[model samples]
Target: MTGSTVGSATAARGLRWLGRWLLRAKCWLALLLLTAVTVWWLSQELILVAVVVAVGVSPGLVGATWVAASPRSFERLAAGPWRRLRWRRVITSRWEAVCRDAHLAERRRVERRSLTGERMITESWRCPRLARVRTTSHAMELIIRARSGQTVTELEAGAERIGSIFDAVAVRCWPVSGSTVAIELIMRDVLITPTIGTEPDGLVVDTVRLGRTQAGRDWLLPITGRHTLCVGASGSGKGSVLWGICCGLAPAVHADLVRLWGVDLKAGVELATGRHLFSAFARTADEAVRVLATLAEVTEQRGQAMAGRTRQHRPAPSDPLHVLVIDELAALTAYAPAEVKKEADRLLARILTQGRALGVVVVAFVQDPRKEIVGMRGLFTQTVALRLRSGEETSMVLGDGMAKLAPAHRISPATPGVGWLVEDTGSTDRVRADYWSDDQIRQVATRFRTGVQAVLITPTEPVDRQRERSRRVRTPKAGAA
Candidate 1:
């Protein structure tokens, strides 16, 4: 049995090699024949004919070698036409029916004032014009012009209806204009179930790529001069966002331009997995209070140092940027003992309100983003709301009236990493957090771990004591006087 298995495997490999060699040979032969014919017709000089043939055959040989080197690229190029054919068929066959069933056609009656001020009633009939349907490797986009008197809110609200009509994995709506909406139908749920690739590279001190949007745009979080809050339900992929930020800043961490401080009150279950990447991490409420205190002290020291000297703080190795990442913020804010909670709140408020300009940032994750839970929610300049339990929860995390439009509460559990990001500009985007598995985190942590740990200056330090001692030493020359 072993011999037979080995024989079959050898045969398959040999066949593959022979087939590749034959393809290269065929290309060479065809190019040689064409070159020979052209040379024969162009000139009778044997030397000129030889030169032309040599140049032509050389190009064919190079081309064949490159083609053999990367077979996957050639296979993808070959399959492009068939993929487009199927995409066109899907669009032509089902678009109209799906739109109609999703209630995109206006069928009701509405009243309008006439030019002469007489009221007139007319059929409120206007169908959504199917402008274009484009298909890509990841998703299909349906651009439609909303009919008269229709708004993007109505179209966005109908996203699930349209998704159900077409049996898509999910649907997202982007309002291109007042009367134009671009609906995206995700054919497959690839965002939540990504195959691990090369570890994500890090960014400069102040930027972090949270993840990519459903349309494949990088969703960057500018942690410079801004605070961020991430809220999601359990198992909704909030951890992915945390690790995404870590991976995006790993290079800076290694360079000592960034110092990461973590407060994982869950006994270090979620964040301790990447223990090597953090400069300082706290696993208990008392330790968390101390961590925040150190950050608050750092913020104060920088503020005094920059007082009246500079308007904005610049990051440097002398004062590396400090980022305090807290998992389950409610544990520190609402669930801790009264003493620890009070101090934690004060330290956190100090950091959020005054730390950004000093290069001290915070990225806090919570399962619920109620004001009662994180009372200083307004202090955060950026917020990302993932899958939630209710519309009110979404609204609370994002803002009022966002629940109906973005509808984060309605996000499917199967698409775990999907969420909505609200920046300081008040613009909202639907994004998916990158899936970072345990193995990927370990690999990145091991690669970027530095031996140097960050040093924090407290309010009381030996430098001040040294200054006082120098003053005394200079004054004690009474004998010489």
Candidate 2:
């Protein structure tokens, strides 16, 4: 009985070695080398005693230093052939359990391994289905591939979904490849996106809630980055989206850090409304240009100052600043001279590219982002598609190819505010835009009514906030007066 027991133990040990070698060969090799070195050092006795002690204490000391540490224990498994067979059996057994006793199902003929290097190409058929929620569409893709092994695969794992340019998708590389693998999956019908916010209720607006309501798992807003473009026809809710963003910006801006430069060509004071805080509002195209130029100057100065700072060592701005909100850009564009427009575009370009680090943010709203308005090459990469008055206008703001949405989402004169947003992130999600009454705008601006900055007012305001700068200028220097 003792000899039999010894033989069983020896077999078990051999199997363990085999499993380790086949599954974790690199780890086992390092473990064996370490064991050999320790054994050799121990043989040195008193001469290497300190070295042995040092080695023995190192792991414990390092582990105690940081609570979140990687474990070195898993590196010590032994290796060999029989262990691989044992592990294979364990895996096979578990896999078989899921299929056992049901039906013989799809049993395959047992065969020897015959694969060398192999590759597979896959394709998926897409179908449009009504979205499960309030979204536009729920997309589904069915994919099939050619391969040789009887392995498991996941739906999203073997598919590639590229967004940004919509109504069409190009298949990039699939995540997984195998022979005879087939899968059917439904892709979500997406949108241009709606501005998002958290409501007191736990319910999330729009189509995708993921698994919960509220911002919960559904909040797709990315915290980093600067710049966004909003466009749509009259009543598409482009104004509504801007309103929600302004509402969100209120708490952020009132935190009393950054500056908001608003340019509204409609000559409306709707957006300038707000609390007792730091802010600036521009009513004309020339005024908008001046404000944007000031931002460019700040950007150049900051970049020069931070040239020596590394990413980890970099410091935030002395103030919290982000999210520029410009309403009715088309109107402003109409008034600026071609040269001034070019200069303003250049400054806006810089803001979109480098403003994130310096705490500068931009959220520009235009009725139609036709290639003509922002230029084919412009700063508005992140766009929100609101309702459009014409199919051509929708195509212009959303890309000529997106013309399909024209007949589908066109806006009427009464929409006032409503549309979808395409955030700075590449995803083209759509949501319902929020809004504010004309009264809300006036209320918000009451506090900022203090007046304009001297630099801004010199060219645009009838009077500057600092009475001394303008009060004395118009009065003529003391000698002139």
Candidate 3:
């Protein structure tokens, strides 16, 4: 029995190794055959045809063979060039068909004699010029220059029509320059499924992997010098984003290297599942306001302490990093009572403007992101918009120009956790937040419960009321009658 098990294991390993080698050898084999054919054609004394073909295919052949031993490396190296070559053919064929079918092609002019005996011909219309083709990791970008009499607006309006002809997942168009336009057809959907990853150790101070981009790149959110705002409708996966942040910071919470204050105005039901992971938690409007005021005071104290000695603050247990996570921000900012709303606004504004320098940051989630509703929206530089109702709302969360580029509104309802992240640099990427099962959340909360040294802040109550509650708790109940 032992010999049989060993033989089976050995056979599996051999098959995997063989598969890897074959994947590498296929690209090399194609290059070798092309090289041999070019040499044969050149040896047959066909000068012009052989010269043109050899010059085009030889450089690629050399590069592929150099990386032939590593299958993954070869795939990465070949992907860009192969896509560029393939897209050129696809564009030339499909674009012409589209132009003809749509009656967008220019007609040739013929000379005609006028009644006054002078020959005249009308000017012919010009076709859109293909400026260049750029291949990204998962999509192809076409840069086009408009003709003399044509406008980029016409091309932008027809982007969807062209996309339908190409069978693309999504089509995006924008002006690159005054006279040029860029049309990108995303051929792949990297975020169609929920990506699974383990909880972060939180030893690293400022980095966390939130999800992945449409290009299969890790979307790392940096919290040291930034604040994040996530906007998504109900059932649009806001919970996933919130818990992803907590899970990534759980280890730091356990170590006391970081402190968390949670304000879930939804009666603490959303964040209560991971209650053990936070230092202080607030459920009501009053409690949330109190927590914000305390955080603002702490920021002020930290700033005063750093005034004389240092200009920058470093995070540690003595003066740990502070993170304020608020779910349903509109309840505090827009829907609270008049007095509580005013106080909440005053305290939150103070924290948002002056907290980053003192190692204090906020991550807030909201359903509506209108400027009037979230008056302090300008303070958050990192914004994530997920599955919004319309393009207007998408622009409200991600910015005006991002509505068409990122297309958060077009996100299918079937895909809940997928969203687009807009950076401070005005670049946009589609990200799918990691989903945590109930069991996984419980496991993380139990494994990384806050320690004894953690300080918790709550709204102060009257001494008599607290004594009465304690007496009631200590009083024993009578036997059943």
> Model 1 over residues 1-481: C-alpha lDDT tens digits?
6988866765665456546655757877687678777777777677877777777556444434444455456436643445656766876787656666777776778899999999988874456777888876556788888777877878777777887766776577767888888878766555655433247554476677767766556777787777889899998988888998887788888887788899999999999899999988889988888788788888888999999998677777666788899999999999999988887888899899999888899999999888889899999888889899999999888889988767889888888778987645344667887788899888888988855665643323336679998899878676785
| lDDT of each residue in 206-277, candidate 3, tens digit only | 877778767566778887767889998888888888888888888888888788889998889888998888
Model 1 quality (TM-score) = 0.64
Runs in model 1 deviating more than 4 A are: 1-75, 78-134, 142-168, 175-182, 210-212, 216-219, 304-314, 401-432, 437-439, 456-481
Q: How do all models score by TM-score?
A: 0.64, 0.48, 0.63
**What is the alpha-carbon lDDT for the whole of candidate 3?**
0.78
Worst 10 residues of 3 by lDDT: 452-461
- Please state every model's RMSD to the true fold in angstroms: 13.8, 21.9, 11.9
Measured with C-alpha atoms, the lDDT of residue 107 in candidate 1 is 71
Clashing pairs in 1: none
lDDT of 2 by residue, 312-396 (tens): 1122224445456678776655447786677677667777777766656677777666667766225554555666666666556
Mark the regions of model 2 whose C-alpha exceeds 4 Å error after superposition. 1-224, 275-278, 310-317, 376-378, 389-418, 421-427, 439-481
